[model samples]
Target: MTSKVDRPPTYEDALQHPKYEPNQLHPGSVESQPPSYSPGSGMYSSSPPSYWAQAGMWSVPDLPPSGMPTAVPTLSGGLPATNPGEMEGSFSSQWETTSVRHSFIRKVYLILAAQLTVTFSVVAVFTFVDPVKMFVIKYPGIYWASLVVYFMVYCILLCCKEPRRRFPWNLVLLGVFTVALSYMSGTISSYYETKAVLLAMGITAVVCVTVTVFCFQTKVDFTSCGGFLCIASILLVIIGAVTAIVLSFHYVPWLHMVYAAIGAIIYTLFLVYNTQLLIGNRELAISPEDYIYGALSLYIDIVHIFLFVLQISGSATE
Candidate 1:
C-alpha cells in the first residue's frame, strides 16, 4: 500500500498575492487601507522620526509624586539640596532659640546665686552672732512666720504665671521669698552646732555641684520622672508629719537620721531633675520665659538639700 507524505507548504508552492486584500482595492469599501506606493514620486524612507528637543528618559524614581526634595542624607555621598537662602534662615532661627535659652539659664542662675548668697549669709550671721542667735532661739514664732511667708509667695509664684513673669514685681516677690526662706534656714542653722552647720553646708555644696554636673553630662531623661517625683514629694511630706508626731512622745535619734538621709537623696534627685529641665533639649523643659520660676525651683532644691544635710549632721553631733 502507498502512503501520502505530510509535507509542510513552502513559499515556492504558494501562489502570489495571497494576503486576500479584496476590500482594500474596492473603492466603496469602508475598510479602505493605505497603499505603500507613490503616485507622483513623493519619496518615502524607512528612517525613524526625529524632533528638535526631547525630554530625558529616566527610570521611575523611588520617591513620592511630589518630586524628590533637594535634601540628602548628611552621611551619604550626595550634595545637599537645600536652598542657600533657606539654610541661613533655618540656622538663624535655631541659633536664636539657643541664645535665648542660654540667656534664660544665665539669668536664672544669677538669681539663684544671689538667693543662695542671702540664704547662707543669714545662716552665718544667725550662727555666729550671739545676739541674733539668742533672739532667733528665743522666738520660734519668727520661724513659723517665715514658713507662712514662704508658702504664700510660693503659691503666688506657682499658681499665677503673670506674677511670675512680671517685671519689677516679679523681682520683688522673689526677693521676699528668698529672704523668708533665708530666715527659716538661719533659724534652723542656729539650732545646730557651728561645726555641724558648716559641715552640712560643705556636703550640700558638693552634692549640688555633683548633681548639676551629672545632669549636664548624663543621657538619663529625668523630665519624665515628674509624676514619680511628685508622688515622692507627697510621701516625703507624709513622712515628715509622721516623724513629727512620733517624736512628740519619744525622741528616736536613729529615726530622724534615717529620714534626713532619705530626704537628702530625694531632694538631690529633684536638683538633678530641675537642672535638666532648665537646661532644655529634654522631653520636658521649662520655658525660657519663666526665669523666675526656674530660679525658684533650683533654689528650693538646694535649700532642701541643705536642710536635710543639716538635720543629719545636727542629729549626729547631738
Candidate 2:
C-alpha cells in the first residue's frame, strides 16, 4: 500500500491497463485520425454527381425550352383536342335546333288556324249572301269545275317539295271557288229554304265540334276502324247509286230515309275515327297535306249529315 503511490506507470504498463483496453471502450467510438489532403485540390472541390447525371440521362426541365415550345399530341387525322368550351357550344347548338323545330311546328299550327278561319268566312258569306235569284245554273257545272280544280290543287300540294309555300294561295283560291260554287248550287232552285239549310248547318256544326273535341280529349286510336269504315262507305255508295238508277220504276221515301239515316251514322263514325287518329296516332305524323285531307273528310261528313237531316225532316213533314 505504501509502494502504489510511489511512481507513474511505464508505456507497456499503460497499454495493459483497464482504461486503455478495447473491451472497455464505447461501441461506436472512432479513432481520432486526420485525412491526407491533395496538393492541387482547393477548399471547395467538385460537387458529387447527381443520380441522372451519373447515369448520363437528361433531366426534365421545369419549363419548356426557350425556342422549342411543347407540342400537343394529335388525335385522329385532322381532329384537334377536345375543348370544354367547344363541347358546351355544340350542346347549345343542338338545343337551339330542337327549339327551332318546335317553333316551326307552332307556326304550322298557326297557319292551319288562319286557313280554317278564311275557309269558314267564305262559307259564311256564301250562306248569308241571298243569291238564290242571281246565280242559278241548271247542271251544277260550276260545282264540278270547282271540285276538279280543288283535286288538282291537292295533287300539286302532295307532289310539290315545298307545299307550305303554296298552301296559302291555294287555300285562298279554293275558298273563293267554293263560295262561288256554293252560291251557284244554292241558287239553282227558286224553292231554297233558308231555315231548313240553317238547321242542317247548325246540326252539322254541333256534331262535328262535339265529336272532334271528344276524340281529342280521349286521345284513343281509331286507326283500326279504317278498314271497316272504308268498306262500309264503299257499299253505301254502291247501294245509293243502284237505288238512284232504280228510282225511275219505284219511289221509296222510307227506303231513301233509311239510307240517309244510315249514311249519317256512318259519317258520324268517320268523323270520330279520323279525329281520334289525328290526336292519338304518333305514327300519323301529319303534314299540311294531311291536314287538308282531314279537313276534306270532315267536310264530307258535314255534307252528308246535312243532306240526311234535310231528307229525313222533309220526309217527316210530308
TM-score each candidate.
0.77, 0.53
Candidate 1 global CA lDDT score: 0.84
lDDT of 2 by residue, 243-317 (tens): 787776898888878887888888899877765544534444344335544444455455556567766655655
Best by TM-score: 1
Residue runs of model 2 more than 4 Å from their true location after superposition: 1-140, 147-177, 180-192, 280-285, 288-290
Clashing pairs in 2: none
CA-lDDT, candidates in order: 0.84, 0.56
Tens-digit per-residue lDDT, 103-185, candidate 1: 99999999999999999999999999999999999999999999999999999999999998989989999999999999999
Residue 265 local lDDT, model 1:
91
Worst 10 residues of 2 by lDDT: 42-51
The local lDDT score (0 to 100) that residue 278 gets in candidate 1 is 98
lDDT of 2: 0.56
